[model samples]
Target: MTGAAPRLRSPPRNGGVRHSPETARKKSPPPPPSSSAGGIWESAHFLKWTAADALRLPVRHPIPCVLAASLLFFMAVEYTLRMIPATSQPFDLGFAATAALHRGLAASPRLNTLLAGLNTVFVGMQTMYILWTWVIEGRPRSTIAALFMFTCRGILGYATQLPLPQGFLGSGADFPVGNVGFFLFFSGHVAASVIASQDMKRLQRCHLARLFDTLNALQILRLLTTRGHYTIDLAAGLAAGVLFDSIAGEYQISHKLNH
Candidate 1:
C-alpha cells in the first residue's frame, strides 16, 4: 500500500497567522486627526460652497430676518447717537491717566501714522478672512449677527460719550474724522479685532487667530495711548465681542435644531 500521505498540519487556530487581505482591510483604523494648516485649508467647507449655492438654500426660519431688522435698528440708533452733541458730564478718568504715561509717544505724529498704517493692513486681513470663512461657508447669518452686535456697541459707545471735563494733556491729535471725540466712549477698532480673531479661531486658522489676537491687544493699547477711546470704551468693546460670539453660537444651535 502506498505510504499514507503525510497529513498536512491543519492551520493552527491561533498561531499568529497572518490575516487575509479582506480582514486586514476591514480592520484598518480610521485616518488620524489632521494637525496641519494646509490640511485644514484643503478640507474647509468654505472652499466648496459657492455664493450661488448659498443663495439657493431656503431659509428654514425667520430668525435671520429678525436678526437683519435688529441690525438695521441698531445702526440707526448709532447714527442718531453720533448726531447728538457731547456733554460736560464727568465720567471716569482712568483712560486719560493711563494715556498720560505715553504722552510723548502719543503726540508723535510719525508714531501715530505708523500705527494707522498697521491698523489698515490688519483690517484688510480681517476682512479677507471674514469673506472667505463666513460668507463663503454659507454662514452669512452668523456674519450678520456679529455685525448687529457691532452696531449695538457703537450705539452704546456714542450714547456714553461725554466731553472730558478737562482734556487729557499730551493726548494724541484728534483723528481725521471731525467730531470723533463723541465716539470715544468705546473703541470700535479693538472690538472689531476681537470679533475677527474669534472668527479665525472658529475656522481653525490658528496662525491667523493668534496674529489677530496680538492685533487686538495692540489696538487696546492704541486706544488708550492715543486717547482714541476711554478705558470704558475698550472694556465695552471686549464685552461686545463676547456678546457677538454668543449670538453666533445661538444662531448655529437654533439652525441645527430647526433643520
Candidate 2:
C-alpha cells in the first residue's frame, strides 16, 4: 500500500491573523432567543433579581429601613383611624399656636385690621423686591421663580379647594383684590417672600434678606392668627418657593446653553 501524504494546514487569509482560544471565546455572543417562553423566563429572572437586590438594601442601609418602617406605621395608623365626618372639620395642631391670637382678633376688630394692613404691606414689599430684581438689578431669576410658583399654586389651589378655616377674620386691606374670592390651599404671600429673600441672599445682600425674612415671619404669624391660611398651606408654600427657584435656575441654564 502507498504511504498516506501528510496533511498540511492552510494559512489565514486576512493578514495571517489568528484568534487565540480565549479571544475567540470572548467575542460578542449571539442575541437571546425570541421565543415567547424564553422572553417570559428572562422577565421572571429579572424580577427575581430586582427583588433580591431591593431586599438587600435594608440590610445595607439601616436608615432606609427605619424610614420605610415609619412610613408603614403611619400608613397603617391612617388606614385604621376613623374617617372625618362629612360635616365636620379636620383638626390641625398648627391652629393651637394661633388660638389665643384668634381669640384676641375675634374680640378686637381694630387690632385685626392693623395686623391685616401690616401683612398687606409685607406683600407689597415682596412684590417690589421681585420686580426690582428684574428691572433694576437685571436679574430675572426671582421673577421667573415667582411666576412659576404662582402658576403652580393656582393650579393646585383650584384643583383641591380647602374650606376657609372657622373664625377666619377678613379685611378689605388684604392682598389680591381684598381676598373677595381666592384659593386657600397655599399662601402666595409666603411663597413670594421666600423667592425675594432667597434672591437677596444670592445677591449677597444679607441684610436685605434678613429683613425680608423677619417680615415674612411676621406675615406668617398674622396669616395663621387670622386663619387666612392653614399651617400646611404655609409649609407647602415655602417648599414651592424653593422648588420653583431651583427650577427657574435650571431653566436659565438650559436657555443659556441653547443660545
For each candidate, the alpha-carbon lDDT, in order, equals: 0.66, 0.87
Candidate 2 TM-score, true structure as reference? 0.78
Looking at model 2, residue 24 earns an lDDT score of 78
Q: Candidate 2: list runs displaced more than 4 Å.
A: 1-15, 22-73
lDDT of 2 by residue, 1-259 (tens): 7999989989986589988888878886977767797677887756666777888888899897999999999999999989889898767667788899889888998888777788878888889989998999898999999999989989999999999988889988777646598888788999998999889888799999999889888888888888888999999988888888999999999999999
- The segments of candidate 1 whose C-alpha lies over 4 angstroms from its true place after superposition are 1-101, 164-182
Best by lDDT: 2
Scored by TM-score, the top model is 2
